[model samples]
Target: MNLFKLFQDIEAVDGDATERLGYYSRRSLLRLGSKALAVSAPTVMASVLNEAYAQSSSVQDVLNYALTLEYLEDDYYQKGNAAANLIPAADKAIFTQIGKHETAHVALLRGALGSAAVAKPAFKYPAATFTDYQTFLLLAQAFEDTGVRAYKGQAGNLLGMDVLTTALQIHSVEARHASEVRRLRGLRGWVSATDEAPAPVYAGEAVTSQAGVDLVALTGKSADRVREAFDEPLDRAAVLAIAQPYL
Candidate 1:
C-alpha cells in the first residue's frame, strides 16, 4: 500500500492540510490554551526513530507508530461505514465521528513526519470481521482499546513536551472511542478481569497499587473498580502483536 498516496487523497478531499490535520494544525497548536507551545520540527529523522525502542528516543518513532494506528482505524471505520445496512441509523453518527478523528490523526502524524514517515502497511481484515453490526462493533472496541493502551505504552518515548502533549490529547480521544464502542456492545466502558481476548490487552490493569500505595487498601475500592479507574499500557511488542493481524 502506498501510504503517501492515501494521505494525498485525504488531503485532496479535505482541502487545506491544516484543517485535515485537526488538533496538530498550526492554528490549533496556538489554540491549545498555551501560546508558547508549537511543533518546531518538520521531520524527526529516521535514525532517531530506529533507536526509539532502545529506551530514550525522539518524537518521530512515536508519531510514526501512532500514524500507522490511525491509518488502520480510519480504514476500518471507513469500511464499516460504507457497508450497506451494517450500522444502525442511530449509531451511524458515532462511526462517522470516529472515522473523522482517525483521518485527522493520520494527517497530523504524516504532516509531522514529513519525509521520514513509514509507508502504510497492507491491511487485511478477516473475512467475517465486518459482516454484521455486532461483529464490527466488537472489532472496533478491540482496536480502540488497543490503541489507547498502545499510546500509553509509548508515552515515555516521546522527547518533546509539545509532542507528548499532542499524544496525550490523542490518547484521551482514543479512550473515549473505546468507551463509546463498549457502550454500543452493551458492555462496561472499562475492561474487566473476565474479559477474554487472544492477547493480554488488559494485563496487569487490575493492580490497585501506585507509588507503594494500594488503592484497595487505601480507599476500600474493589479490585475491578480500581482496574476500571486506570488503564494499563501495552509495550511496543504487545501492541505490534495485537495489530499484526490487521496489517
Candidate 2:
C-alpha cells in the first residue's frame, strides 16, 4: 500500500492518522514528487509497513498498556510505604519519593488519556512482600527494571508523536529509580550479566551485540561492558507476562 493509504488505515484503527499525517506532512510528501516512492523497491516499502503494524495496533493501545503497568507500580509502592516498618527509617524517604513519582506518573498518564485511560487492575504480591525488607527490595528492583524495559519497548509505538518526548522523560526517571534500587540491594547501578534476580527482568539483557554489530569484537570492549553499554528493549507481550503474576 502507498504511505498515505497505509496511514489512512491506521487512522481508521486508532484515530492517530491525523497525527501521523502531521508528522510526515503533506509538504514532505510533495517534496518527494511521487517519483521517489515510484522507484523505491517494493520489498523495502513492505518491510517498512510490516514494522509499523508490528509496533502497535494503536497509539491509544500502547498508552493503555503503559497505564496498566504504572497502576501496578504505584499500588505496590503506596502499599509498601504505608506498611509499618516496611521501609527502614533511613531509607523511608527514598521509597516515599519513588512512590510519589509513581503516583504522579499515574495521574499524568490518566490526564493524557482522559476517557481512553484503562482502569487499574488488582495486584498480587508475595505474603512477605512488605514484611521482609529483602523481599521488598527484590520486588522493587524487579519492578523498576521491568519499568525501564517496558518504556523502551513502547518507544517504537510512540515514534513520530508528541507523547514520545513525555514518555522518554518518564523513562529517564525510571532508569534512575532502577539504579538506586539496585544500589540499595548491594549491586551495581546498571543491569549486568551477573544480575539474575527475577530472571525475566534480565532476559535478553546480556546481549553483547546490537544492530548486528559485535560490540565486543569491533570495539574491543569486554562482554560485560558491551552488554552494560546498551539497555535492551522488551516487546509488549513479554513485559505484560512479567507483570502477570503481580496482577
Candidate 3:
C-alpha cells in the first residue's frame, strides 16, 4: 500500500503497542506481526507523514523540522548502543540515557505539532570517519552544539507564546546536554566556568570558531551572523541533508 496507509496502520496499532511499551522484546514484537504492521512504525510513519502533509504556511513546520532532527539523534544513539563494539562498555549506559532523552524530545515536539507533525524523511551523516572514542565524542559534541544553535535560530519562527516558551525551555536543555557531553570529553569544568569550551552563550556569542562562519556568505551580513559562533544556523534543507543518512 501507499505510505499514508502505512502510517494509519501504525497509529491504529499504537494503543496495543503502548500497552507493551518498556516490556516488549523485539522478537516478541515480531511474533505479533510487528513487521507486517511496521508501516506505522516511528520512522516509517514519520516519512509517510512528511510526504503527505506539508506545513508550508504554519509555525508547525519549524517544530516538525526540529522534531525530525530529534528523531535522527535518538536513532543514532540507539544504533551506537547496539554497536557496543564501537562504544565503551562504561559509556553504553550513558549513551542509552541520552538516547532516551532524545526520544522524549522527539515525542514532545511531535505532540506539540499535533495534527501538523510532518512525515519523517530519510537522513544520513557526513562521511567523516570516527577513529576512536575521542573522535566519537568530538562528533557528538558537534551534533549537540548544532542542535542547540538550531533551536535558538528558529526561536523567532514560533508565533505562539506558549510554543515559544516551550521551545526555549527545550533549547536550554539541549545546551545542557552539549555541556555535559563536552565535560565527559574532558573539554570543560562544570556549568559555572568561563573556559573556552563550547556551550550556548547568549544569542550572538561564538559557538565554535572552526565551523562557526561562512566567510564567503559574509557580504554585509547582520551582526547576528558575524558575532555568533557555531555552524551557521542550518536551514531546513541543510538540516535534512545532515539527517537523511542516519535514516
Candidate 4:
C-alpha cells in the first residue's frame, strides 16, 4: 500500500515531526473507521487501513515495531523459564513472574492489533546464551532496560490521549522490569553514567541538564544520581541495533 510513501507525505506536513507524524497517524486510522486504539494495536487496523484507505499510517508502523520487540522479549523469558537448571532455585519464581508479565504484554499487543499484527520473527540465541544463570540475568537486564528506553523514545510519535496513556502505562511496567532484573543481577536498580556496555542504549543518558538548568549544579546532586533521575530515549535505529542480535 505504499506505506513508506505515506510516511514521507506525513513528514512533509507543517509543524514538528512529532506533531506531524501523530496527526497523520491519527487521521489515517480514523479513515479506517477506528479510533486511535493503542500503540500495540496495528495488524488488523493496518490491513483495514491499507485496503480501504489505500495507504498504511505511521501509527501502525510504530505499533508493528513495538509488537516485534514484545515478541522478542516474551520468547526470551519463556525460554529462560523453561531452560533446564538455568535459573537459580531462589530466583526461579521471579523469572516465572517476569515471564508471565512478558507473555501478557505479548497477548495484549497482539489483541490490540487484531489481524494486522506482524507474525513473530524467528529468533536466534547463541548456544551459550542462557546456559549460565548469570549470563541469562545479564541479557535480561539489557532487554528490560532497552525496552524501557525504547518506549520513551517513541512517546511523542503516538497519537491520541488514550493511545499515549496506554503507551506510558506499558513504559512504566518496562522500567519496573528493568529495575527488578538489575536487582537480581546484584547491581543497583538504577543506572549510572558509567554503565555503557551497549553504547546505543545508554548513549546521551549522562546529560545533567533539564529545562535549560544544570541539574547537578542546581541540586548539587552527583552526576550519577542526576543521570539516574531521568531515563533517556533511544531512537529507532539505536533500538534496532540493540535488538538485531537476537532477531
Give per-residue CA lDDT, model 2, range 64-122, as digits (tens).
88889899989999999999988889999999999999999999888766666899998
Model 1 shows how many backbone clashes? 0
Comparing 1 with 4 on TM-score, the higher-scoring candidate is: 4
Which candidate has the highest TM-score of all?
2
lDDT per residue (tens digit) for residues 128-228 in model 1: 76777777887898899999999999888653445677889999999999989888888888776645454466665666787788888888979888778
Q: How many backbone clashes does candidate 2 have?
A: 0
Q: Quote the lDDT for 33 in model 1.
A: 40
The TM-scores, one per candidate, come to 0.75, 0.79, 0.55, 0.77
What are the C-alpha RMSDs, in order, of all predicted structures? 11.3, 7.6, 15.5, 9.7
Candidate 3, residue 206: the lDDT equals 39
**lDDT tens digits, residues 1-247, model 4?**
6866554443332113445445666666676554535553576445444443332345556667888888998999989988898988898888888888888888877776667679999998877767888778878888888998888888887644345676788889888888888888777788775655556667778878988899999999798889889888888999999999899
Off by over 4 Å in 3: 1-56, 126-131, 189-247
Candidate 4 colliding pairs: 42-113, 43-116, 43-117, 44-115, 44-116
Evaluate all candidate structures by whole-model CA lDDT and list the values in order. Answer: 0.74, 0.82, 0.58, 0.75
Residues forming the 10-long window of minimal summed lDDT in candidate 4? 9-18
| Model 1 regions lying over 4 Å from their true place | 1-57
